[model samples]
Target: TATGKGFTPAFVQASRGWTAGQWAEARDRLRARGLLDADGELTEDGVRLRRDVEEATDRLDHAPYEHLGQAGVERLTELAGAFTATALGNGAFPVEHFGKG
Candidate 1:
């Protein structure tokens, strides 16, 4: 899905700590399922699947944030923002691959 979203395989593998063989197998499976192309680009089905998965994840993850309440959530976000920026500046993750969300 990261590849589908324009992230390079090397970046994904490095960031996720996936062995080359493991990444290859996953890529092959996605391609066989018609979710990815031979070049690793995502098909429309892949895009939809990624979106659904992300939505489901967000829904499940929201409970803790809800428990924190709006102000708490805002404060958490503010606190994290600086750390995130520092990580970005330090090349903890590729800035180009990081989305605003």
Candidate 2:
């Protein structure tokens, strides 16, 4: 879905530590499911599906943050934001590829 959202397969593979074959297989599967087009772009349904999955993932991941409480969550976010910015600036990952929605 990252590729469908405008990331390159290479970027995804590199960032996520997936092999080229694995990425290709996943892409093919998504395409077969009508989530991706022949050109590897996301169809409308693909976009919706991706958004739904992200929402569901966020819901599932919320428990850890809740356990931290509001203030702790805020602090963690602040610290992580700084780390992320530094990583972006340092080119720890492809910013252009990862930054797209």
Candidate 3:
């Protein structure tokens, strides 16, 4: 979800619950590796890294819901999509990142 422009430490911390220290260390590493800028925006390399991470996490996130079956998955997806749309509408998320329309 963060491969888009303006990816930042705050965005990740809000979702991943990382500690300050962890984020600091990660920020340093990202800069040294030319993945992120000082402000935490992803560089091109960072975008690639984020894409890979997102792909892996997407798979992991899907497994637990496998027991829900196809119809259940569809229902859950619809609900989740609605929530995301609402979040976007309320300016809780960047439309460019979350908008599927």
The Cα local distance difference test for each model comes to: 0.80, 0.82, 0.74
| RMSD in angstroms between candidate 1 and the native structure over all alpha carbons | 3.1
lDDT of 3 by residue, 55-87 (tens): 999988877688899999999899999998998
Q: After superposition, how far is residue 52 of candidate 1 from its true place, in Å?
A: 0.4
Candidate 2 lDDT tens digits, 1-101? 44645566667788789998898899899889999998878899988988999899999998899999999999999999999999968987664665554
Of the candidates shown, which would achieve the greatest lDDT relative to the real structure? 2
Q: Write the per-residue lDDT of candidate 1 for residues 1-92, one digit (tens) a residue.
A: 44645566777787899999999899899888999987777789988899999899988998899899999999999999999999878997
Off by over 4 Å in 2: 1-6, 15-22, 95-101
Q: Model 3 scores what on Cα lDDT?
A: 0.74
Q: Model 1 TM-score?
A: 0.77
* Candidate 3, number of clashes: 0
Ranking of all candidate structures by their TM-score, best first: 1, 2, 3
The segments of candidate 1 whose C-alpha lies over 4 angstroms from its true place after superposition are 4-7, 15-17, 95-101
- Scanning candidate 1 in windows of ten residues, the lowest lDDT window is 92-101
